[model samples]
Target: MRKYALLISLLIIISAINLNAQDDNEKQLLKQFHSITSEEMSGWLEKLCSPEFNGRLSGTPEFVASAEWVASKLKEWNIKPAGDNNSYFQWFKWPYTIINETGSLTLNLRLSDGSVIRKNYQYPNDFYPGMNSGSGEITAEVVFVGFGVTAPELNYDDYKGIDVKGKIVLMNRDVPHTDPRNPEYKKWVAYCYHQYKLENAVRHGAAGMLYVDGASANPNITYDPSIIVCGIGPQPLEDIFAGIKTTNKALIEKIRASFKPASFNTGKVMTIKANTTRVNEGRACNVIGYIEGTDPVLKNEVILIGGHLDAVGNAGRVVNGALDNGSGVVDIMGAAKALAQSEIKTKRSIAFIFIGGEEVGLIGSKVYTANPSFPVGKSVVFINLDMVGNGTGFYVSAGSSYKEYLKYFEQANAKYIHRPMRTAAPEAGEYYGRPRSDEVVFRTAGFRTMAMWTTEATKKVYYHLPGDDTDAVTIDIMEDVAKMIYLALTEMANDPEIKF
Candidate 1:
C-alpha cells in the first residue's frame, strides 16, 4: 500500500510541475505582448489620423503616404516585405465615380387625358446619383416590379412574366415584408442588397432601375455600374404613383401581408438621364509584411492579420477616422511589433497587411483576394481589427463561427485582461448584401475570418463623422485589445492542431 501511495504522489508532482511550466510560459508571452505599450499605439494613431494624412482616402497621395508609413513601421520591426516586386506594396488600380454638379434627374409622367405632368427632382434631396451609375438617357414606359427579387429557389420571382425590356423598372428597397422578429428577417435583409436587385433588373433586360425607399431601406444606397440605377425619395416616389389606383402605402402593405410578386405597368411613360464622371485614379496598394515560421511543413500555411487603412476622405471637414479604422491600423501595428520583437517563433507564417480602399467599398480586400500575394487556399485563418479602440471591452464579430479561435481569447482574458466579451451574431452587420468592412471579403474568399472591435453602439455617435478624431479612442482600451490580439496570435501560431 505504501508503494502505491508513493507512485500516486509522484504522478501528482509531475502534473503540477507541467502545469507550472505552462503557467510560466503564458506569463512570458503576456510580458512580450505588453512590450507594445499604450504610448506607442497612441503615437502611431496620432500620426495616421492627423490632418496631414487628409483622411487617407484611397487612390490619393495621402493614402499612399499612409501605406508608406505603415511599411516603414513594419521594416523597423524587422518584418520582411511580403508584397509584389520585393516591396511592401501590392498595387492595383480602382475605378472611382464622382457626381458632378451637372448631374440631374427629371421625371415626366404622361397622363391618359393627353396632358403631361413634369417634375424635376433636385439633387441629394429628392434623389442622388448612384456611385456606379453610367451616363445615359432613357424615355420609356415604367414598370412596377415588387422588391426586384429573382429567387427561383424560394419560388418567388418578381419578373415572372412581365416584359421589362427597354423600360424603367421601379422597385422597393427590401424583400417582401416579414416580421422583424422572425429568424429569416436577417437573411432577407442580406438578400435585399442593391447588387441582387440590380442583377435581377439586368437579367430582365430593363433599360433603367429605380429603387423606392422602403420602411427599412437605407437612405444612402450605392450600387455597381451595370445599368443606370437610381434612388428616388418617398416624396418623388409618391408623385410617380399619384394617379395610379394603388398608392405606395397600399402597395407596400399588400406585399408585406403576402410575400408575392406585385408586378404591374404604371401606364405612365418616364424619362431618366444620369450623367456622372468616372476617374481611374491610377492604383492604391495593400501594404504587406511577413514573419516566416520555424516549422518546415506548417510554414507553408499562413495566418493573415489585417486592418483597413483608408477613411471617407473629407465631408466639409477632416474626417480623421481615429476610431473608424485609424485605431484598427494601430492595433495591427501593435500586434506586428509585439510578435516581431518577441523570441517566440510561430509554427505557421504570419502576414500583416494594411488594406486600402475599404472605405469606398472593400475594394482593396476584394482585389487582394482576387490576386493574393500567397495562395488563399493555404491560408489557415484571418484576423481583422477594425474600430478596436472605442469602447471598454472587446467583441468578436462572427464569434460563433470560430469557437476554437475564441478559446485563446477566453484564456487570455482570464489571465491578463479581464475585459468582458460581448457577443454579436455573425449576421449583425451584414445587410443589403454588403459587409461592414474588409473582413467580409476574406470570409467570402473561404477563409475563417474573425473581426475584433469594441462595443459599437457605445461609440457610434462619432463613428463616420468628422468628430471621429483621436479623442474617441481610449488608449487603455486599445492597449488591452492589442494584448488580447497578441495572446490569440501567439496561441494560434504555436498550436498545430488548429486547422483552416
Candidate 2:
C-alpha cells in the first residue's frame, strides 16, 4: 500500500512539472508570435517589390541577389544550411528571356474603297508583349483556332479544315473542357498547358499567335525561333471578331456544347512584333535552410514550408509581384524568424525553402523533389503559400486526409489569430491534374501537400500585370498568416504522436 501511494505521488508531481513547462513554453511562443507584425511584413513586401530585385525573374542576376538576401536572413537567425555542399542554394539550369521593349500590335482593317485602316493597340491596356516570344515580327492574316487544341482521340481538332500555315492563329488559353470537378476533365488536361497550346500552334505551321489572355505578362510558353506571340485583350479580340456572326464567348460555348472544330479565317490581318533576347546559359536556385529538432528520433522527421520567390520579369514594364508571391515569401520569412527565435524546443525538424522559377515553370520544385535535401518519405507535410496577402481570412487545402496535422493550425487560428479559417481535402489517390503550381509538382513527387491562401479579397488583384504591386497586399492578414504558421508549425513539430 505504501509503495503504491509513493508511485501515485510521483506521477502527480511529474504531471505538475509537465503542466508548468508547457505553460512556460506557451508564454515564450506567444512572445515570438507577437513579434510578427504588419509593419514588418509591409517593409518586407516593399523591399521585395523594389526595383533592385528587377521583378525577381528566375535565372537573372537580380533574382540571385534576392536569393542571397533571403539566405542572409536565415543565417542571421542561426538556421543551418540544408542546401548543396553545405550552402543555402540548390542550383538548377533555368534560362530566361528578356523583353527589350513594349512591342506593338496593329489591326489592319479593310475598307470597301480599296483603302485600308490600321488600328494600333496600346501596350498594357489592349495588348501585352509575350514574355517568351521569339525576337522580330510577323505580319499575317489571323485564323481563329478554338482553344488551340488538337486531340484526335477525343474527336476534337481546332486546326481541322483551317489552313494556318504561315499565318497568325488567334486562340484562347485553356482547353474546351473547363470544368475541373468532372472526371472527363482529366481527358482534356493535356491540352490545358500554355506550352502545349503554343507548341501546337507552331506544329500547325502558324507563324504568329495572339493569345486571348488580356494584357497580362505570361512566361509559361514555349519560345520558337520562327514565330512571334502577343497577348491581346478584349479590344483586339472584339476587333478580330467584328464581322463574325458569333462572339468569342458564343463560339467557345458552341464548341464546348459539342466537341467540334470551329476553325475559320477572321479575314483580319494583324502585325505582332517583339524584341525578346533569350539567355540559355542562366542558372537559378532554391534557398533551403533547416532548424534541427531536440529529440533524436523525431529530429529525422522534417516539416517543410515553401513559396515561390520568382515572378514575371520586366515585360516592357516591371511586374511587381507583390501579392502574387512576394506576400507568400515574406510570410514564410516571418514564420521562419519566429520559429528560429522561439525558446520552445521542437521535437521534429523544420525546413524553409524559397523556391525559384515558378513563373516560367515549376523548375525549382522539380529540382528539389528530384534531389531533396531531406528524404521525401520522412517529410511530415509540404505547406505551400502563394498569393496569400490580399484577403481578410485564411484557407488551407489538402487537410482532410491530414486532420491530425491540420488541428494545430486550427488551434492557432482559434486561440490567437481569430480569423475566418477554412480547410479542404485533397482529391483522393494520384493527382492527374494540370502541372501549374509548385504544390502540384510536390504532390506528383509523392509528398502530402498542404497549401495556405487568403480569402475575401480586399483589393483588386492584378495577376501577372504591371499593377501587381504592393498596393494589392493586405498586410494585416499577411501578419496573421505568418503568426499562424509560426505557432502551428512549432506545435506540430513538437507533437510526437503525429502520423503520416
**Which numbered prediction scores highest in TM-score against the true structure?**
2
Q: Please estimate how well model 2 matches the true structure, expressed as its whole-model Cα lDDT.
A: 0.89
Model 1 CA lDDT for position 229 = 61
Segments of candidate 2 deviating more than 4 angstroms: 1-20, 428-432
For residues 339-407, write the lDDT of model 2, one tens digit per residue: 999988799999999999888878999999999999998998999999999988998877456766678
Q: What would the TM-scores of all predictions be?
A: 0.69, 0.94
The CA lDDT of each predicted structure is 0.76, 0.89
Q: Which ten residues in a row have the lowest lDDT in candidate 2?
A: 424-433
Number of clashes recorded per candidate? 1, 0
Instruction: Provide the clash count, candidate 1.
Output: 1
Please write out the lDDT profile of model 1 over residues 19-78, one tens digit for every residue.
Answer: 998898777786787697999899999998877787776766777888999999999999
